[model samples]
Target: MRHRHAAAGPRRPRLPLRYLLPSVLLVVVVVMLLLRGYVHSEFLADHRVRPPAPTGTVPEKVLSGGPVLDARGETPVSHRVPDHKIVLTFDDGPDPEWTPKILDKLAQHRAHAVFFVTGTMTARYPELVRRMVEEGHEVGLHTFNHPDLSYQSSARVQRELAQSQLALAGAAGVHTSLFRPPYSSTADALDDRSWPVAREVARRGYITTFIDTDSEDWARPGVDEIVRRAMPERPGQGAVVLMHDSGGDRSQTVAALDRMLPELRAQGYEFPRLTEALGAPGPHSAVHGTDLWKARAFVAAVGVSESAMGVLVVALAVVGVLVVARFALMLLLSAVHARRVRRRRRGRGRDGRRPQVTEPVTVLVPAYNERECITATVRSLAASDHPIEVIVVDDGSTDGTADLVEALGLPGVRVLRQPNAGKAAALNNGLRHASCDLVVMMDGDTVFEPSTVRELVQPFADPDVGAVAGNAKVGNRRRLIGAWQHIEYVMGFNLDRRMYDVLRCMPTIPGAVGAFRREALWRAGGMSDDTLAEDTDVTMALHRHGWRVVYAERARAWTEAPETVKQLWSQRYRWSYGTMQAIWKHRRAVLERGPSGRFGRVGLPLVTLFTVFAPLLAPLIDVFFVYGLVFGPTLRTAAAWCGVLAVQAVCAAYAFRLDRERLTPLLTLPLQQLLYRQLMYVVLMQSWITALTGGRLRWQKLRRTGLLGSAPGALSGSGAEAREPHGLYGPGEAREPRTKSAVG
Candidate 1:
């Protein structure tokens, strides 16, 4: 009905250029602004980094140097990638903000410098440490207590250094591999300044830095006097200048930076991170220098020219685009296939001749403590408008389900009783005595339409179709939560049906309303109680045996949805976990040649990537766009982000249009991006861990809302078939000829 109405809507005409010109102009302006921002950020990042360079001619100088391991051998401290370098040193400071202010000034010039931070100051202002790393600055360790090196004992110094290292690691994600001694001068009496501290730092893999130049007035001097004092000694190649950002007001130092940083970067300085300057790849792979190096290496290894490498990168990107396009095309094709199959099956013959088919259906409804709804189930079945033997399996229902069935006295409505075995077990027991050519499985809580049974059974007219699933709609969608679920059901189940129609691989035939051939169900073992997701398990089992499962969208049922966040979470957790379990159980058939192997080349990857990776990628995509906004290389970077966002919006809009929903929820897509989607990760992680540990989890019972709560019709009292001797409680009560029996 919904589909028919959608088709009837007046077609919207395409807008003319006059209508679109403003939009185009707006887009262009946005692109230009983004590009401008990107360029500015790149320039600022390039300019602010530092290690003072050789003065006379080369503005930005690159130098290679390292720690003298034994004052005899240069131990490699950092492995600088070409065009990127790191500067090494200590901070907090000389009990001084002057040290850090000077450091900040160097950073403005785009020079890399390491700050071995004191534990005391780090504790006071850890934000500075975090900002340093976040802004591509390296953090090293100064001592914990920040005592003068000459006054501290060997053991005391070691303890202080260790504590500081641990503190830095814990607070700022920095594991210090370098240390700087206080004052950069050793005391001879105790060898406290160098030997002992050096040994302790070296033992922990720290490369201690020896500063080549000091402004000296760190102890005392006027800002102007200090600038004059420090300006004469021009920095040579790889010169480490000591400075501070904490401990004192160093406004003078800040003043001098306006003169020094840009002048120096303008002089040709490459400010690499300390680690990069010392010749090591930085933490993230996005760093320009490292990516270029890796690309070069890959090209070299493949014996490809630079031009070939460029071609390969372009080819890889193009392939990704092609794959995504193919996937979308395949989805559309599947939808068309499903629609055709449905139309063919549904089309009645001319002259109105009845088709010669007398296959009776045994509809099984499994209920647990569902006395209130059991009557509805029986009444709906009695009203099915098709010949169906309704069997309600009462799985340990302490409620008056049996009493209610006896009172209803409905013909062809039977009640089968069993212990509190799970739904799967109850269904299996009920199936044993089914005694019909076709079987339909449903939940006691659902109420089916009068035409549901007829529509559901229509698909079975084709021998190729083993099972058909009915469209399950939210029976109570007045509340926000239920409405959300209604939308989700339409998107997930409906979308899947379309895809399956094309691929002929239906991953699930929901237990709520699935019709199956009795023989097919028997061939595949009857539902087992082991898996939490019995419906998914059974569907996969049937699919494994080369049976075609289908969707009967017009065969509708109204069922309950979780009404609260907690209930919804619990239901989804079980569902997600169960789906994963079913997938794992049938993993071999995923990509292997067999009756169940259709999904290997396409379906499996699609399912895994879309269901699993898509949620994870959501956060990353968000971060990427935000980063581009904050620190884009050129205005084009911002424009690229807008392009990405625009494309996503279009795709989402198309999906929503296909599903036939109101426009209000479409706006919630971005809100879902902020909160709802993140829940996927939490559920996935939990489900994965549960699977790994083989932990048995109890079924999460969703609390009732009673919003659309109406009592179901009573069940008809019936016992198991005598011929098969399959009773509800146990197998084979008394062997006899198998015949259909609907008894109370």
Candidate 2:
């Protein structure tokens, strides 16, 4: 539960991940799958290619039936090749290693070859592309970004072709009228579907290219096998041999090139660039400074994207590790707390000293659109055995919340109406008219048990105790969402409260039901509109101002929790974000001495880590699990995921048992993590965003279901026996304190 975007609406938390599910997330997954399929089929699959340096083939009708273009997509303006001549071409590169090495090998063999370049890669390694042009090698276009033109729109195809041309012109100060569609193996391989794209290319005055022979060196097969594959079927055959200078470790290609070029020459074969064999002009486009900078920007953008991806992976791993570590610490600390609580319980018996306080308490009920449950809340408070005064502060609810309270005409209950101020202001208004030194704050949507206030005020018997946090349970927990919330309340909040009790760092006295000494509240500056979680902010202020906060678990109240995911998100976002604000607001307290220093040093970090940072990091576990399912050791990954799940299940089960809740809802914990947990992580992220950006958060109203509806005496009372006959402290016989453990 998180929130604190302090604004008009209860500061709504951006429910980041829940917003992803059932729609936006579906689209993301579909797009990823489509992209993966396209990349795999087009580039990862084995295919034969056309001429290494050829672009689009010339259309016969336009060229008036020029001599047939060869496998390199190069139109032979004149077939001036010798009988023993061979054209060696390398497609898809200007690789730093293999390209230069191939160039060196070619230089050593006194041979030249054409290199078809992908635009992005050419832009990235412009110097290499420049070297190709300067070393008597031809350069051609192989589409920007390397998408298969067969699947691309005409506009996309045009951009791909033109971008490659621009990249070549910028990188090497030259461009060719050559073009090659991605995934091509041979000129003959261009089907009817691709011929139109080829003709479209020809319309732009570019010639297409393909390969007559393939080296298949991208697979890193043995050097000898690559050499064997590159040789033509017959000895001294005149053909275009295709190879790659990039895409993977091309050492075998280099080695094969080292071995084959000499062997081909021994067979009286002459390796020539496609231009030389076809007697075609080697075209080069003029360059400009703007084009060069544009190419530089493209390369820089690619580098940044790669760096960002690496950073994301590292950050996710760090978050996952921290979340795991935090959970382990929670288990450790919770165990220590449980042992201490048990020891204390065993030490205190019926004969132990009993807390007696007969002080008249003032209860504040803050309402907005709570008409449906306001009466029930008043009735429950009216039934408190201890002497009390009830004040209802209505924040101008159009739902007749104030009217219902006044209509009840309940003794000791008064309704005070104010303009539509926020919850914090409403609380402040309640504080203004509260007449008793002891005050209890209750949400209008909550129903307290008869003895809740009596049990709550008992902690004040210790002069040092300034506030008491009551046990808050989910009342509307019938639906799956509500049931999940129920589990969270018992398993997360209450369990943490117990540990916080032992640590004496209880930061929040939940608004649903909390007891505070009037003076303590006043000393803490009462409630402020600065934070949507005024209850939390004020409680932390009390801690820093040297006030002791305790939990009265027996003081149970049923709160009407949000029934739907949307309502839950809004409530929690405010909580998480507001909590962040409060933490930062009181950060300097850590340097102080005494109680404030203790809480600031211990409590603040604990709460921030477990409640805020840990939840934010929790998403990384899911990310890793999903990634592992797709690309890692599946069996080990599943075991590891299940291991974490089992540990959490055990913890939740222990919490539920301690809380005396049924194990039934515990079954939904895993399902809850699938969707509900992500919602929480997103809320925390939104809070951090709010904090970082210093954005205002507004109040978000949730529709009430009046789920905690009950008559004044519907639930059993803890009995008025703990009450004193005369003054609260002048008791004759007082029941000994049962247990200080948080309300389970």
What TM-score does candidate 1 get on C-alpha atoms?
0.53
Worst 10 residues of 1 by lDDT: 718-727
Instruction: Give the 10-residue window scoring lowest on summed lDDT in candidate 2.
Output: 721-730
Candidate with maximal TM-score: 2
Q: Which candidate is the best by lDDT?
A: 2
Candidate 2 residues 1-744, lDDT tens each? Answer: 111122333334644443444245334433443333322232233244433343345343423322224323443331323457777778788777778898899999999887888876786577898888888888888877776676667887887777777667667676688766677765555555666677677777777766667888888889999998888777766777778998989988888888988888998988877767776676666666777677555545544444544665676677667656655665677777667545545656334664478989999988876766777788878777889999998876765778888988899998888877667777778888989999999888788777888888887877888899987887767789988888888878887787788789998999898999889988989887677778889989999889999887668788778877777887897788789888888899889999999999999998887888778767656655765665546788788888878878988888776666678888888788778887787677766777776776665666665545552234434532211111111244232331211100
Give model 1 RMSD, 1 decimal. Answer: 19.4
Q: Which lDDT tens digits does candidate 1 get at residues 1-744?
A: 000111224434423442244345434433443333322222122222122223232111111232312221233232222331214344664233465565566666655566767764554344566666766667767676555554556676677776565445444645556666655521111132344445555665666655544545455466555545443244334435455555567665567456544544564545555556555544322223544454333223222222343443464355445435544654576457556754565664332333534567899988765654666667667877678898888776555667777689998888888766668877888898797889999887677766677778877767877888777766665566665566556655666666765676667778778888888888888786546778877787887888888887666666778776777777776777777777777778766776677754445555555554454334434443444566654477567555654554554455445544444554555555445554554555556556666654446445442233321211211111101111121233222231221110
Q: For candidate 1, what is the lDDT?
A: 0.57
What is candidate 2's CA lDDT for residue 616?
73
Give the lDDT of residue 488 in candidate 1: 58
Clashes in each model (backbone N, CA, C under 3 Å)? Answer: 55, 49
